[model samples]
Target: MRPKITLALNSLLVLAFFLLLWQVLTVLLHVPAYILPGPIAVAAVVGSRFSSLAASFWITTQAAAIGLAASILVGIAISLIFAQWRWLRRLLYPYTILLQTVPIVAIAPLILMWMGSGIGSVAFIAFIVCLAPIIANTTQGLISVEENLVHLFHMHNATPAQVLFKLRLPHAMPSLFVGIRISSGIAVIGAIVGELFAGSSRVGQGGLGYSITYANAQLETNYLFALVLAATVLGFLFFFLGIFLEWYFLHQWHESRRAESGN
Candidate 1:
């Protein structure tokens, strides 16, 4: 059997077991739907409200995608700059790390104040949360070039740009992809946080965060569970998107993928 196929089947079996447990627990405990809906009930709600839920989910996903894309561009650019000069990295990297210490919720309101209440502000919030990992990972990747390689480049009288594009960038891609994966996952969390602070929808237009909030306010546990599941699926899609990218970029030559592929 193909490894990917085997892995998928195993994942499904585990998911089925947990879902069975969830159903049994709810029935055994006689939990009220409003308080603790079973997976079955959540599935039913998902089926019944598929349209509205899907619409809201798309909104949140768009914000996450936007933020993650921005983080990738800015992260790579800044990482290159850091690699080019040690002084800049020393002066600016601390502030970059500072972003991780503060909670997204704490700064979300300030973003709302600056960017206003809209998708742009929400994307900015996600951008902030997703920025640190990429910068940190990519910077290390660039700086960790082999000493012999640096000498080789210098001996060839290569320009800094030539060295970076030809040697450093290629070397750093694995780490860059790792950062991409991490940023992709956290981007969703950032979007959810942004929506928690500033999410509002007019009629049919809403995001998952807004739906979750509305469900809780109205004591709709099944509906909340359904939206949460949709958000989970959305995040999973983004994560696997990163995985596919990693595989595409690195599978050609990276030893890890080569070994995995048994090539």
Candidate 2:
């Protein structure tokens, strides 16, 4: 089948399956809107609160963007440091894994309490959540460089900086994208967690977390669903943006992209 047709069919299948399950639950379980609002109700709420939702979304997106950028810069720097020092890598690797496994939810409130809430807290949380994936992936990419290639560079009297820039960095592009994709999802979770703990009462900040809190307090299930759907869409957008960037950069020469092209 043509790619477009295959994609369309898959999308339709997914939508149909979800709709079917939602309708069944709504009808058979007699689930109240308070407990689980139907998709239609959620969509309606989304439409009605588009303006307010859009503002909240913008705030969250800004926070995520700042944090992800910081992650990329810091992760790359840390990776390069480790790549240059094998012993340092060995010493730090276990601690890196420990950081990734630590629960962000548990730490978020502490972050807020320390930072005194607002954008600083949210951005810090997002950075903490997103940084690990990039650091790990970048380190893998740097170390994965071929021994023969390194020897060739050395024989050519290449400086360490030259070798890193001309060889390892280029080779690491695929792994970099992998880290970026993982960081995208983590950034969204970080932002939401941050909002849960550090949301502002002032206008023009905070996001789905605050919306959900307000709607729940007011017993507006539909509105709560709307906020949640907004968050889900934001997460999906981050994931798909990473995918598109990966394809755009790697499609010319990468093995995965080449396979797709051949098909």
Candidate 3:
């Protein structure tokens, strides 16, 4: 409790300090609102368009969540296959990096042409962006089973299924969550980029990415910053989800997480 409270208080203090510094700098530098809106200006914009921001945020959040779910399911399946077959990992693992190296911007257009607009394409983009981390981490974890334990199982004539179900998957949880935490950020990026090519939602509705583009086009800097802040909050929310899962699953038994109290 002490550590958690200390961390939370530190985070709040840092955030407040930066916000104060930003306000002071904006005033001292005589920065125009169009160039750089201070926190007060951004906060006012947020208040004025709170409903619209909430709607857009909800849309993006749904898309990102769906994509993240798909990535987790598929990533685990793929990792299991790779771990079960050594040759397959050697043959195909190199290409996993391609998923990261390839720019989403370049492929976003192709996906748009193929799938057109809406959540389908957006979710696909996000899935592609977030899938790599899950695969890499899960595969590493699944294969990182203790050699002594593995040999003991073998010596005991334990079947592959028993060894896998009883040993490997459990051991993989820590690394899997690490990847999830990393992928949480990537998922947000994918959703926003996906929205860029997916186009605005029907009529005036769309995700924060659309709002950002629209605000920039009209030079509504304060509103743009507000939208950006909304996205930032969404990203943090997604990341906290991974943290919660890690604590839930790891706290009880994992030494790294320290006996169910805290990680």
Candidate 4:
């Protein structure tokens, strides 16, 4: 069997073993469904509440996707500016770091206040949470180009724009992708956090965070577990999307792709 297939099989086996153990322990110990719903119970909730869950999933996905896309575009632009100006980078980069250090929960309300309670606010929160990594990694990549190659470009009378576009950007692709992968997971968290405060009030109109809050309030442990699973799946989707993009862009010449293939 191929390595990818084998790895997937291993993962499924582990998941099966875990679920089996969970079911057995719950049954043997007489654990109440409220305290810990077994995987079977969670699956039942998933089946019964499929439409509701799917609607919420789509809401969260929209927020996360918009935020991630904004972060990529704006972050890359900021990184390019930083790459061109050392003094400006010194002045502004610390503030970006400070932005990252501040808790998103603390600022989420302010975001809702400024942007209003909607998908836009949620996406902004996601953008705020995930923007720093893109700026950091992409800035490093843009600046870390080989000095020899830079000199070669200069010798050919390459303009600053030419050097930036032709040499620096290409060299930065791997690092940019790394930032994107890291930020993808964070974007989901931000969107969910945003939804907690800014989600719609109407039934079945909110995102996973709203569903989670509703479940907790109702003390519906089984439904809550299912919602949690849905959130996890959403995060995984973003992460795998990042991985696919990295492979698609870098597979041609990057050493990482070669290493993965060999392994």
Candidate 5:
């Protein structure tokens, strides 16, 4: 209870301080509203257009969800492949690095060309962006299963699938959850990036990305800020969801989170 209260208070204080600074900057610089609208102005724009913004948010969320699911499937499959075949891990490890280093900005255009416009392209981009972390972490977990445990299972005549399901998957839970937490935010970013490259299918209905682009074109600084705020909120929600899941999973019997929970 005390920690939760402290966290809530800290969050409020930070938000208040930032809002104050923004308001002050707007006045001191005599900043044109087109360049940097004050927080109040941005709030007003968000309040007025919230309904339309919500619709775009729904589209963005759908893309993020689909992408995240795909990432999990691909990640687990790749992890299993690498775990079973040491030779393949050695061969494809470099390629994994290549994928990570290629830069999402450069790849988005190619994805757009291949998948065309609409949710498919966006989801594909998000999946690609989030795939590496899951693969790497889950592979580490799957491979990190205790040798003694494996020997014990083998002595019992346990099959590979049985050992994996009973022992390896349990051992992998911590690392896999870490990957999940990291991938959630990445998925959101990929979705937004995909939207930027592909643009919105319909007018008056794009994700936050479209709103930002539209705001820039019309020199509507407040609207731009509002759109950015929406995106930030979206990312925060994803991160928080990951945190909640981790708590739900790890708090039960895990030492680290159990200690944190004072259980």
Candidate 6:
């Protein structure tokens, strides 16, 4: 069998084994459903509340997607500026590190106050959470060009803009993708965290974070499990999307792609 197919089958087998063990442990220990619902119970809740779960899923996805997109555009621009100016990078890069060091939960209230408790606040929080990685990775890639290549461009008398666009950006693609992959999962977590504080106040309208809070309050463990599963799936969706983009763009020329293909 092909490697991809075999890997997928192995993953399914592991999942099956885990589910079987969980079910057996719950049944043998006579565990209460409220404390630890088995996969079967969670599945039932998922089936019964599919619509609500999907709605919440969509809300979180929108927040994460918006935040991630903004981070990519803004982060790349910042990285380019940093690459062009060493003194500015020295002045500003430490602040980016400081921002990353601060916990999102600590800053989220300020975001809510500024942005007024909506998707905007949530997306901003996500953007803050994911921005540092993109800047760090892309800046490193942009500055790490080969000395020989720099000399070649210098000998050609290439303009700064030409060198930046034609050389730095191309060389930075792999690193930017790495940052993207890291940020994709982080954006989901940030969105969910943002939703906990700033999600819609309207009845029956909110994201998975709201659903999770409600489930915990109501002691609906099975429903909570279902919501958690939905969030996990959402994170996986973003991560796989990043993976696909990386493969599509880099497969032809990148060393990583060659290694993956055993070339």
Rate residue 225 of model 2 by lDDT. Answer: 78
lDDT of model number 4: 0.93
Best by lDDT: 4
Model 3 pairs in collision? 251-260
Deviating ranges (above 4 Å) for candidate 6: 2-7, 261-263
Q: All candidates' lDDT scores?
A: 0.89, 0.86, 0.89, 0.93, 0.84, 0.92
Tell me the TM-score of model 4: 0.95
lDDT of 5 by residue, 144-245 (tens): 988899999999999888887788877887888788889999888989998887757677677777667777888988888888888888888888887798
Q: What is the C-alpha lDDT profile of model 1 across 105-219, one tens digit per residue?
A: 8889888888777788888888998899999999999999999999999999999999898989889998999999999999998998888776653643667877788888899
The residue ranges of model 5 lying beyond 4 angstroms of the native Cα positions read: 260-263
Tens digit of per-residue lDDT, candidate 6, span 73-108: 999999999999999999999999976899899889
| Candidate scoring better on lDDT of 4 and 6 | 4
Worst 10 residues of 4 by lDDT: 196-205
TM-score ranking from best candidate downward? 4, 6, 5, 1, 3, 2
Please report how far candidate 2 places residue 131 from its true position, in Å: 0.9
| Pairs of residues clashing in candidate 6 | none
Better of 1 and 4 by TM-score: 4
Candidate 1 or 2, higher lDDT? 1
Judge candidate 5 at residue 168 and give its lDDT. 80
lDDT by residue (165-194, candidate 3, tens digit) is 788988898999988988888788799988
